[model samples]
Target chain A: SQTIHQWPATLVQPVGSPLSLECTVEGTSNPNLYWYRQAAGRGLQLLFYSIGIDQISSEVPQNLSASRPQDRQFILSSKKLLLSDSGFYLCAWGPSGGNYEQYFGPGTRLTVT
Target chain B: AQSVTQLDSHVSVSEGTPVLLRCNYSSSYSPSLFWYVQHPNKGLQLLLKYTSAATLVKGINGFEAEFKKSETSFHLTKPSAHMSDAAEYFCVVSVGGPYNTDKLIFGTGTRLQVFP
Candidate 1:
């Protein structure tokens, strides 16, 4: 059984602070990874996705960036956080090929004050 | 370009009543549709998916969704609503060519509120 993990479960940061969120998957290899942000009342926005190591795609132009350092390890980072960057961050993984139904991690809730 | 629309931003239902969350999608190809549920401050969970097979799909926790190509809709439903079912639901569409990295387009989401 495959599982996705993310941390820290919750974080509170001041504006202009750096941000780093980690996601890792077990029981799968070469899976596609994705980062999404969900704002209150607003729908989820896809921030980035990676097909493989060093192959990252940004869906929205924002302060956040994503990287796939290892096959199953993905990281979301930002040099400086904005007030608008506060939201629930989600990490998801899908099979490399086929239907592409994604599985999500527990998620990280960031509050930029 | 592919997109999804959740017909309702919020839906309130009494416990034991039937639940319906409507969704519509637009896609150039035979799209793959999915319904995901998210509890408060939690990550989204897969409720069901329609991938070119089984118009009627059953999901966890007594949830189900029907895919109607003519209507371009994939609405989720349950016979009886439970308090635990109160959450936000998102309709998703997969966009990509035959050999490309598929991107999922998500709807704004419909928040389900189950009241006793």
Candidate 2:
């Protein structure tokens, strides 16, 4: 069984401060990773997805960037956070066999004040 | 390009009643569709998926969705609603093949409220 772990379930950051959210998958190696954001009660918006260690495709342009340092490790970062950047950030993963169904992590709720 | 539309933003039903949530999609090519459920403050859980294999797909928690190509709709239904079924549901579409690099488009989502 594969499990995804996301850190800092809830975060409070000052506007203009930096941001970093990490996600790691256990029991699954070399899996595809994704980043999504949901604005309270709204639909999820895809932010970025990585196929490999350095192959990343961004769906939306904003204050966030993603990196796949290791096969099972993905990180979402921002140099300067904005008020609009506050939302529920979710990390998801899929297997290399081309399964469309992705398992998601608990998510990080960021409040930019 | 593939896209999905959730017909209802919210649906309320009494416990033990039937549940219905509608979703429609637009795709240039043969698209793969999926349904995901999210509990409050929880991550998304895959309900089911359609890859043209079966017109009807059964998912977890006694939920099922039927795919209608002519209507371009994939509507979810449950025989009986449980209070635990209250959550937000998202309709997703994938443009590529079953095993390829595909982008997923999510609908606005339908929130379900089940009451006793």
Candidate 3:
């Protein structure tokens, strides 16, 4: 069975500070990785998706960016965070190709104060 | 392009009553649809998916959804609501094909409230 892990389950960052959130999947190789954000009382917004190492497609223009440094490792980063950046960030992975059913990680609650 | 619409932003049902969360979709082609659930402070869990294989799909936790192409709807239902079923439900549609860049378009979401 495959498992996804995300860390710093909760984070508190000052506005204008940098941000970094990591996600990794075990027991799967070359999987499609995605980054999504959900504001309080709202639905998820897709931020970035990576098909392979170094191949990332961003769904929105914002203060955040994503990278696939390794086949199973994905990182969401920001040079400077904004108050609007505060939200619950979710990381997900799916089988290669057009499989839309994805496995999601526990998520990171980022509070930018 | 593919999109989904969750009819109700919030629904309240009494325990032991039937549950219905309506969803409608729009797609240029035959698209895949899915329903996901998220408990408070928890990650989203896949409840069910419609891949054209089955018009009626059964998912975990006694949940089921039926796909109606004519109505362009995929509505979720359960015979009886449980307290544990109170959560946020999302309807999603796939926009890509096997040869395209795959991504999902999500509905605003419906919050299910099961009350005893």
TM-score for every candidate vs. truth?
0.96, 0.96, 0.97
For each candidate, C-alpha RMSD in Å? 1.4, 1.7, 1.3
User: In candidate 3, what are the lDDT values of residues B22-111, reduced to their tens digit?
Assistant: 999999888799999999988999999999898999999999999999999999999999999999999999777333456888899999
Expressed as tens digits, the lDDT of each residue in B1-116 for candidate 1 is: 89999999999999999999999999887889999999988889999999988899999999999999999999999999999999999999988623356678899999999999
Please, what is the whole-model Cα lDDT of each candidate in the order they appear? 0.91, 0.90, 0.92
The top-ranked prediction according to lDDT is 3
Question: What value does DockQ give for candidate 1?
Answer: 0.65
Error of 1 at B112 (Å): 0.8
- Score chain B of each candidate by TM-score: 0.95, 0.94, 0.95
Per-residue lDDT tens digits of candidate 3, residues A60-98? Answer: 889898989899999999999999999999999999976
Candidate 3 or 1, higher lDDT: 3
lDDT of 1 by residue, A36-90 (tens): 9988788878898888898899888999989898999999999999999999999
DockQ score of the complex predicted as candidate 2: 0.63
Worst 10 residues of 1 chain A by lDDT: A93-102
Which candidate gets the maximum TM-score versus the true structure?
A: 3
